[model samples]
Target: MVFSKKRSFTMLAALLMVSLLLSACSGSKTDSSTAAETDKASDSKTLTIMAETSSHADAFKSIIPDFEEKYGVKVNVVEMPYDQYQQHLKLKFISDQAEFDLAYVPIGWVPEFQLADYITPIATEQAKLDELELDDFPGIDNAYFGADKQLYFLPYMNETHGILYRTDLFEDAAEKKAFQDKYGYELQPPQTMQQYKDIAEFFTRPDENLYGVTLMGENSILSGFGFYNRLFNYGGDLYDSNYKQQFNNEAGLNALNDFKELFQYASPAAKQYGWSDASSEFLQGRSAMAEMATTVAQMAQDPNQSTIVGKVGFTAIPANDANTSDIKRFYLPYGFVMTKNSDNQEAAFQWLEFATSQEMMEKAAPVGNIPARTSALTGKLASEYSFYKPHADIMNSFRLETLPLIPEGSTITGEILPNAVVKYMFGERSAEDALKEAATEFDELMKSRGY
Candidate 1:
């Protein structure tokens, strides 16, 4: 009886083991199917976007809820400070660890990103291109192309440097007449550097409440670009086709001297000023005029930030010379790019298309950014925004010239020239001495990079 019972127990154990195996197989199949469904749901659509901290981004986020409701996908927006965003992005792309799927890049930085193989070309979607009206975008769609002609980015915001003036201060007919009498022209916003200088000088009353022009005089890429914009307008180029430093010439010296001459009338703190300081002083009614980015139009009109709301006027950057033929114009374009490390290329492209689309422009234009799309500018969207109309008019009137689209353009403008220009501006060195010294340093830097 004991042997029979032990044999039955052994058989019972074997039967239980077989039943467990069958259950395990069924569970494995169910798990596999659940995982496949989860992956399919995840693959439906999602985009992670990195954007700069601009009023534009705020407007974008405000409308994202609507975007999600219309489209089936969700968008995650990551806003970053302007200064640190580029470095953060570079780190993300280099490590192939970017959490974000798309980024808003300064149009000039496209080359650097492309050189690192971080960004994918927009032309990757030929079918999407056929559906989108790319020609509606202003400036150059090809601005993001590499030397080999690969489209790596798309312009999200088309910006230009323009004059932002206090209309309340200049509205007096007598003051306007006096300005015209002194300068031999109407007291309109200047079209030439000489006229700009005259207006700056005319408006300056250091002992009174107001001063003359203020600019971004701090040593940074923006400052360097500002100086070069003037220099280029004055017929100076940083490099020839051979990539040699040619800014040590007379045109450069003249540009430097022109910049220096403004110190007599500019605010005493101009040396410490960047875009923020300049914008603040101008908005606070501390300065008569300022050369500023087009985005300042919103700030100038905002009742919250500006004391001179609805009393601000806009105009193009002053030409270098009196002759229209000799005038040189340059504007920097800012845009969006997709990183190569992004796993969701299609999603990223869709987000880029949407952000740069007419719909987004309608939301963004009211916030004071110059929309990249011509349709957005000409459409009811721009007309509804009282402040953007003048800026749009100015942008449309010009062909929009820009510096050469090269990889080293940012470094040259930001690192090399800004320091040299500041040193000259502060009387630390003469313009010639500063330019000569800077040229030597820049040449060495380029050589080290094997440029």
Candidate 2:
């Protein structure tokens, strides 16, 4: 479906303008444009960055020693788990107790941060952005702009969701012949839901101690990412155009039902699996397939952590054969944003400049990073890695857009929606009821905020 970028960008400010800031942690933001840097980055001896513990963070982080020697500054990094990252950053910023100079922001949090005025508008850094060739990164975040059309962060890495499976198993002569005889179809990467299910079931051999898939069923925003991949595949969104909650309908039900089916083929312990857990299952060669954020799945390429490095194969998420829908693949942008209340804005910008430079992006690429740079994606790495072309195709797709942007976005995905999804997966509720509960609660929140 054509998710209207223009439409969403226009709605960004209007949707978030009325969000009530936390009164307990009230603080003022610096006026970066006209004011002098609170501490000149050049004079600052130390810089602190808050990052989530992920490949994205490690890409730039592993090379920080080079930055320190070049700039002569100490860089201290605080890493948080994905589940805790949001709340921790929010409390830190809203309470006026933030010590972070810059943090790599996920796309979902940009609107909330902008609406709450927790970050500085970095329009003044246009020169640095130009030097870094900002256009080299995916432009999805540009369509999520606020009323001022200002950028609040620097883009570093972008990724989308796609399927990863074992090529070794799929290509095995004996296994393929057996799969063909039993399933009556070629045993290759899944292109249809029925094929996906059959292959998942085929690979599920309990005696071999291997399951079919690594289904991440964690009860957090990770579930949102997991569920929304299915939701988007079925042409479902969190809300309809009228600001009405419509996900309790057919598309939503179908997406949620996917989990119940996938559950049968994944590890019984997958009931509690997060992305990290799910990837581990696949990396250790214990599971056959996993739909992963493109960059996260790059872990399969690491010889240190992965037993199935060369065996891994990548593909787009398969669709239900009945629904001839053009899906928007799950995509997100991660980048560094300077906190308005930070004491080290100047140094943070310097770090951003260094991290996103073309040279640095290329450097990060070889170090197990899916760098968000045009050159990196289109360069020799595209031929070196099996997934780079697919990743680039999703980014360059005209249909590419972001997930819904609203002030209550975090609550909808992180809490309400995922909770209901988990309940449905555990058979605590029917698909309809679970989605209804989530959609209703989301509507109430938006209404209370005057959306």
Candidate 3:
């Protein structure tokens, strides 16, 4: 699933504060109903879950039957579009509606959920942790819960960007010779940002209705993610160690300029592209390359949806001049968050454990769900999946460290900074000016939140 903007921290904090005040003056009317539901859950054999209708849902469907047979519980899963899932969940939570027992949460949403008390710590039922094989998920517990050291969600999938390119184009003898003659290097997957640009420009054939690369030019969270991935790879940080804004540096400028250059080589509709648009561009053989999540590897190879089925290749995103690593990738782990007010915490946790178990993840691996569990990621399952090795290697070696893990961190990364990228993309502001605007907003947010 693609990245989507989280609720703004300023708004979330204000809403939560109001919720607290309201509950203080008049007790929660749902409390008694919630207790009743808890008792009902213990006797009933049904549970509800809300999740994104992506590959994850596909895999969930396959394994859900087994879980249901084992627990004798019927689970009704409500699948929603990725863009709507966050806001939908927020509405349900704020309204004190226990419409679902568990939710598939993006890691970036954990802090917001925590602030609203929408999710309970996984530690509440520590005994279940052992049975789920907690140690199997290396770096996951830390990656998702390191900020407050409270495990609020069970890791389901870890997503990171990778280059999906047309192998047939790279291997064409005539094109290869021409590329080498013109660029002085073998035509292959790019290892550096400059090489990436050169290749994009080289393959650009606009008259033929084809272009070089697919640009995530939409002024939304995907655009933000697209920009920050490059910004970080270019040695830029959203903020310094002390949490002050620092994206107005040379690295940010270079990254932005490089990103802008790709638009010239991108499709005419590049300005409207998001993650799905980019994926479609590569799958339909419209562009030479696309930067997308590793999860797309399966989709790119599927004969039904892709014309480039056997011609696609996967690799890490290119590195900037200052960065030593050939591929520096940022990862966001998706997990299952059990609502704090769930009447059936026990049953919900059981479902949570079942969903994230190594066994279930192994089953999902073939269908494009990248496992967060070290055992699952490195086990025979990954080896059997043709596209998993390179992604696994990138995950192990080149994980990009992102912004500080403060409560407002997701808001900055997912919203404020992204809005700046949108501004620059639309010619409303220069790169430096846009980042400066974001920096000012970031500082004010952090200060207001008592950072």
Which 10-residue window of candidate 2 scores lowest in summed lDDT?
A: 27-36
Counting clashing residue pairs in each candidate, in order, gives 0, 0, 0
- Give lDDT per model, in order: 0.74, 0.76, 0.75
Residue 205 in candidate 2 has what lDDT?
87
The best candidate in terms of TM-score: 1
Give the higher-TM-score candidate: 1 or 3.
1
Please provide TM-scores, in order, for all candidate models, with all chains considered together: 0.85, 0.84, 0.84
Which pairs, if any, clash in model 3? none
- lDDT for residue 217 in candidate 2, whole number 0-100: 83
Which runs in model 1 stand beyond 4 Å of their true positions?
A: 1-44, 322-326, 381-399
| Candidate 1, 216-237: lDDT as tens digits | 7889865675677678677787
Residue pairs whose backbone atoms clash in candidate 2: none
Cα lDDT tens digits, model 2, 102-203, are 877787788888888888865465676566566667773563357877778677887777778898988999999999999888899888777888999999
Between candidates 1 and 2, the lDDT winner: 2
Q: What is the TM-score (0 to 1) of candidate 2?
A: 0.84
RMSD of 2: 13.3
Error of 2 at 75 (Å): 3.1
CA shift of 403, model 3, Å: 6.9
